[model samples]
Target: MSSSDIFIGEVIGTAVLILLGGGVCAAVTLKHSKARNAGWLAITFGWGFAVLTGAYLAGGVSGAHLNPAVTVGLAIEGGTEWGKVPLYLFSQLLGAMIGAVLVWITYYGQFQAHLTDREIVGGPGAQDTVKAVPNSEPGPVLGIFSTGPEIRNVAQNLATEIIATVVLVLAILTQGLNAEGNGLGVLGGLITALVVVGIGLSLGGPTGYAINPVRDLGPRIVHAVLPLPNKGGSDWSYAWIPVAGPLIGGAIAGGLYNIAFA
Candidate 1:
């Protein structure tokens, strides 16, 4: 495939990933809904399947490094071209944004309806009750459409992202190392899916374990742009951790894998 084709594939693959990924979050979190707080198990499995599909669709043509961290890690490990790294990252981010935009559109009506109902139910004096709704707060913030530990401290959140990314990258490296083919085939993809499930089941409690920067930032950008009642976009503050942590973890995993095997 040409570089342009690779770029297009990455963009489309990443978009699909975030659409399913964040769509699940919206399904489970929004008010007056059926899937609220259903369980972390569901989210984990959903994400696993989502990634599997995304990989199947894009792996052949573009290697499906839907996450920038993954692309960087592969490049650093000499598995991919350094010159293509920027293009891959840009494509992933663009795809993520597109996916996020679709997610916002999919759930916008529901969000607005919930918000309006809440206002009517609460009347003018229920400030606290309104604040409890996801994305109702005014300004940039994480976990607006999701839930994490009660503590909102940055250090704790960053730690959660770091650990989650470490586990995810490690899993990716392991799969990359042992797979028989150049790209992950069906069996290999299934194993990678399981890895995501494990991460979500074990490490998803804090900050929702958004191990991919595209996964987190893409949806967060949508949250900012979409007009929902009493909504605020928490940008810049906690965003960096998701981007930084995953890249660091991916690099570490690549280095460790090389040291152990090479």
Candidate 2:
């Protein structure tokens, strides 16, 4: 495919991923909804399916490494061209940002309505009401942005993200290796979905298992700019963990895969 084609596919695929993936979160979290606090299982599956579809769509063109961690990891593993890495990573991040923006637009009306209802129900004395309403607002599930451990500490959250990303990257590497010059077809994608489900079921209670910078940062940006009831800016305090953990995990997975297979 041409360079322009690759860029287009990256943007469209990432937009679809975030639209469906983050859209599910909005459906579940926003007030006056049926899926409120439906638990991490739903989210995990939602993201998994999102990634699967996105990958299938863009794999041929851009390889669908929508997450920077994945792109970096693949490069380190010698599966990706080094020269193309910068372009791909940039495209992925840009695509993710665009996708996140689209998600915000799609859900803005619902979020506004929910926030207005909350403000009315809570009365003027509510803490959120007392705070100055910003030009933009955060999303309903704000916790997803920053890592908060079950123990409510940074170390734990970092650990959780690292472990989750490790599992995710490992799954990807394993699938690639097992392909034996062949490609992972649909079954491989399903395996990835299952891996996400496992992580959500097992490790999601803590840190919310960011596992991907694009997954967290893109949506977090939306949360920061989109109007809502009582939204806050990007939770910078805990933001580093999601990015750091995923990168470390991907690196570890790549190294381990190399050792085990070589």
RMSD (CA, Å), each prediction = 3.8, 3.5
Please tell me which predicted candidate would have the highest lDDT against the true structure: 1
Question: What lDDT does model 2 reach?
Answer: 0.68
TM-score of model 1 (CA atoms):
0.85
lDDT of every predicted structure (CA atoms): 0.70, 0.68
Error of 2 at 99 (Å): 2.0
TM-scores of all models?
Answer: 0.85, 0.85
The list of candidate 2 runs beyond 4 A from truth reads 119-140, 144-148, 177-184
Per-residue lDDT over 1-262 for candidate 2, one digit per residue giving the tens place of the 0 to 100 score: 3567557767777778877777677766766656767867778788778887887787666666677676666767777656766776667667777777776677676666665654533446444562434433332346533334556677777778888888888788777533211224667767876787788878888777778877777666666765555564466666678888898888887788788854
lDDT of 1: 0.70
In the range 135-206, model 1's lDDT, one tens digit per residue, is: 444332235332344467877877777777777776776675332213566677778788888888888777
